[model samples]
Target: MTEEQLQALLHEMTTAEKVGQLTQFAGAFYSEQEDSTPVTGRIEFPVEEDMIKESGSVLGVAGAMKLMGIQREHLKKSRLGIPLLFMADVINGFETIFPIPLGLGATWDPALIEELQTISAKEAASAGLHISFAPMADLVRDPRWGRVMESTGEDPLLNSLFAAATVRGLQGKDSLIANDRVGACVKHFAAYGLAEGGRDYNTVDLSERELRDKHLPAYKAALEAGVKLVMTAFNTVDSIPATANSTLLRDLLRGELQFDGVVISDFGAVQELIPHGVAENEAEAAKKALEAGVDIDMMSLSYAHSLASLIDEHMIDSTFIDEAVLRVLQLKNELGLFEDPYRGVSLEKEQTVVGHPSHLALAQTVAEKSMVLLKNENVLPLDKQTSVALIGPYADNQDLLGEWSIFGKTDQTTTLRQAVQKQYTHAIYAKGSQLYERDEELLKEAIAAMEQTDCLLLALGEGKDRSGEGRSRSSITLAPCQIELARLAKETGKPVIVALFNARPLDLTELEPYADAILECWHPGSEGAKAVVAILSGKVNPSGKLTMSFPRATGQIPVYYNAYQTGRPLPPGSNERFFSRYIDIPNEPLYPFGFGLSYTSFGYSNRSLSSAKWDGSGILTVSVDITNIGEVKGDEIVQLYIQDVVGEVVRPVKELKSFQKVSLSPGETKTVTFEISHDMLQYYHSDLTFASDPGQFRVYVNGSSVCEEENTLTFSLVKS
Candidate 1:
């Protein structure tokens, strides 16, 4: 339909019909139930039959035939025969799950991530899903926040790159909402990652400068990449709930960012305004959200029950409802739903594409590149003929798919023991202990297996349910029983290799002492086990890096690499008690960001600069020589970091500017070059001005964020 025809249809919509276009319900709302009451969060309210038919969209429902039945029935009662849009939380993958978003970030390969998301889009679109609430752009610095698994990491620049890549992958490079593609929704609008105490749904307090500099860039990148929709956060921004914050939604998101796309609330967030103390009742919640430019209310009745009456009572203008309804209609038309309601949904195609062998192969490659080698004391790359013992809660368990994989099944996932058996016929398996509990019989069996094998590969970490939405933890450490299991295995004097399967960064203080090698295998989706075996057998070298820093202890909750310099900063190896240093522990993380290990070592030498000064408008080229000095062929992620010597505000010690993944044969030498422009040095000032100042800068080129003095080069930025 043309814009004129959509406007004409909008003019024919009744007040109730317009409000219905702004309301969304879940799959269960359309099912027959004895209780006519519908629940949103904790509150239950009566939903009339007509309200169901008038709803603009449905959530948590999929499958080609099922959606066809719902849409066929819905159009019969829609009066104007408008088709309902189907949305789901297809965060990481649709059926053939990939590693959690954090693990994907560890690859430092946005091009690979784009390919993975394209496969995800194809699978999801085949299953009749029109929208995927994914590519979460929240900048997370705290590991205690369970939702960190959904984010790409803590750095704004890297997150922005991945966010844009995700959008392009899901929506297609041409921005066409084609039959094989699904529209992407960049989520949580603003800074939901900075929740205080790292608790889920907690308060977020930050300056507008902080919000703009560190948090808002990724969402803007997604929108700039042509995302079709935006989802509001469940938390507050500047003390106002994001769903009702006019400054955030209207001025920043829509006005300044120029996003004319559809805006929808997070699940039940509109009704949640009452508990947040921002609204007196549901009616007031509807008024505030609509005024704040929220277009659709998800799993909430506030819009359906109050919007028409608010317009009738002159409490709100009817234009708000009309404008929102038009956006909804426009999205449907853009999706080509008006022409073919099914939109190429076919059960045969869904079955053929989802979880296909090619898709699983890609998932395996991603999982292999995402597994970080945190510690290796000559215990990794085990000989294929070596006898190994696979023990712990995850030994034979199939909960390899991480949280937010709504469509992935555990039955389809391969377990560590199964993969080990396939790789090495001399391997034995035992369940040492439950995740959070101890059992003497299980311990004895595990110790027997450990004594019988030449090496111990302990599979341990939080369960699949431990990290995702609303699964925050006060202490981010392994359970005591699992720790004890590791201790007992170490007593046998066999080489202990810890393969950690988790979501967020964990406190490795307890388990670090006993392991000869530690592999941070984050919830590696369907082909995770196969990838792990391949790495262990020397078929694949570990090349993944840490995106989020691992805290030494739970006390270091919000630790990250790109922290601002402090006055009276503690000098390295200094014993001064008066400086800004922790008395109980060192301030450094257990594992810093961009830190990882490969089977082979690479040596850096001879750093050079094109010029000593940049005139602020031209590019300055920096180069360094990297050679594979070890005996094995491997891939290395060379990172480039910059430090602004002086600024209007305190700058980070070092910020990641660029990175490159290079494959090198043994004894091969390669020179990696980077071009730095004036825009790379810009920062948000006290007055919110984003520009670089004339100053001296230090550049470091190495394999990780921690750079040695010899690897650093000095340069200056002069006024144009």
Candidate 2:
């Protein structure tokens, strides 16, 4: 924009007017689902969408603006005459929800992830939303942490790439364009996953190295992708709340990285700092925040109330206020709002265009691609004549779309029972439990259903409400009643298939042993029912792998595959004293990362690598032959992982370098190959420099992260 226009905007703002831009309010309007998913909380709100525009030349407002019509009328009343940007928690979908992120991560495909977010953005942008809080980049280790379902997984490198992909999907080339896309916000700026005791909104005490190497890669990747905005975490990093940490705000984010976008706080995060004891009062919280470079406050009155006095006292510089307001205005300018504030406003096309069938198709493709077959014993892909019994709270559930599916229509999506009834001639269903049920009647019903059918499909797991933000579990086990029903089903002598509708992994020791097949369906959105049907009818082959590790028990709370080995290593085949291995149970998780099963089997040749080559100019080709040993056709994700033979410091035993998802006809042999460049082999070392060292390398081509067969390569990194 012309400096003249910017100066004109700043010139009209009184200290009070400018302070108004700094504080954001949650409009009283809210939305809630009726006939809610059992475990999903009863939090509801009215759709007051207009409160946003009514407040200002915007300062900005979270969704449910108090009055749709009035908000527009009054927003023009502001001194600066700018429109408010409507913000909301567009976690998975706005209207056409997709599967939860963890489930998407299980697919381990960035291209598909980018595609789904593209669909999500289209639906959300059409609904008058200007910005969406999405693509959560937390590196989760504990399944007990309910929000684990929201992040990708525990690997920094993989999650980093996904984070960037999500940003690109939502923001398109220019979200701030005329009806093109909505702005994307990469969230919880710091390490929110390290919350104390794996609880949400808890304190985080972490070393700088750990912070940079592990929790910060995703955010850096998002920044590099040109994300228009950033959000602060709710917890403290070291001793300072992330919302008010100047080092994170000014020194690192702005000074070092040169991120020119506005910094938005997490929901009510600015005020939350007061209760965190970092700030004395709301007024002080505002002082610390504006000083720390937080440009916008979400759902908090702190900035709205105290910024004027801070500015008058010279405690907060006018230049800082100018910088903050300019960032918001620059976005408005980028969005061409200066040209026309009504760019995205429309009601005539809303009815027919928003949740149409094309949108449903996109959701279905994502759901189909995201479903991971965790365990298969040939109980899946049943013939049309098989008399199957579908049982579980989720079997008949109208809410199969999954977590973070905020605006989805339950009736529109297909249910497991409905999908099954359409296929089998004599399919029966039983609730078994209330999802958290331990009642005897439910168990009796489940057993009865199992007795009537030749096979059983139990859909018992966490409900949609049990695994999002502010939702953590003390026990990562199957709900009590489901276990009893599962135990009983084991004795029925029928082939049992467990369809898990949970966001995170469960302690399947009691459940897995009793099941012949298991499908981890993490809340497939709108086409969720259709995706389940595809898997059941063998229309779409399930090839998704686990991005997160499934622990054998809660005792392995922070379980993950790529974790650092304990100083005293546990011998896999031998027992040694004082090692990290548990006495009663093995330290290994129930399933390793990149772990999945297919209807057909695959074979991997022992890995082979070429001799050493130069770092900057060399290309490493690692190939594998995957044969479909089963009669049916299928797809396989051949994984290639590399280990640094030696490094300046200890490193993960192996890191996933490249993978290919190949579809093969029955008995069709295909060669899958990946090229490893210097960038793929580099790691951040003691000096914070990333490089591929001059040393030998070991490569493994296997089905997943845990490779039973492998080979080696010798490569050197000469100066480029």
Query: Which portions of model 1 show Cα errors greater than 4 Å?
Result: 32-44
Local error of candidate 1 at 585, Å? 1.5
Best candidate, lDDT-wise? 1
How far residue 177's Cα lies from its native spot in candidate 2, in Å, is: 3.1
Candidate 2 residues lying further than 4 Å off, grouped into runs, are 1-3, 29-70, 175-178, 612-616, 709-720
In candidate 1 the C-alpha lDDT for residue 665 amounts to: 92
lDDT of each: 0.91, 0.76
Q: Report the C-alpha lDDT of model 1 over 630-656, residue by residue, as the tens digit.
A: 989999999999999899999999999
CA lDDT for candidate 2: 0.76
Q: How close is candidate 1 to the true structure, as a TM-score?
A: 0.98
> Which residue pairs of candidate 1 clash?
none
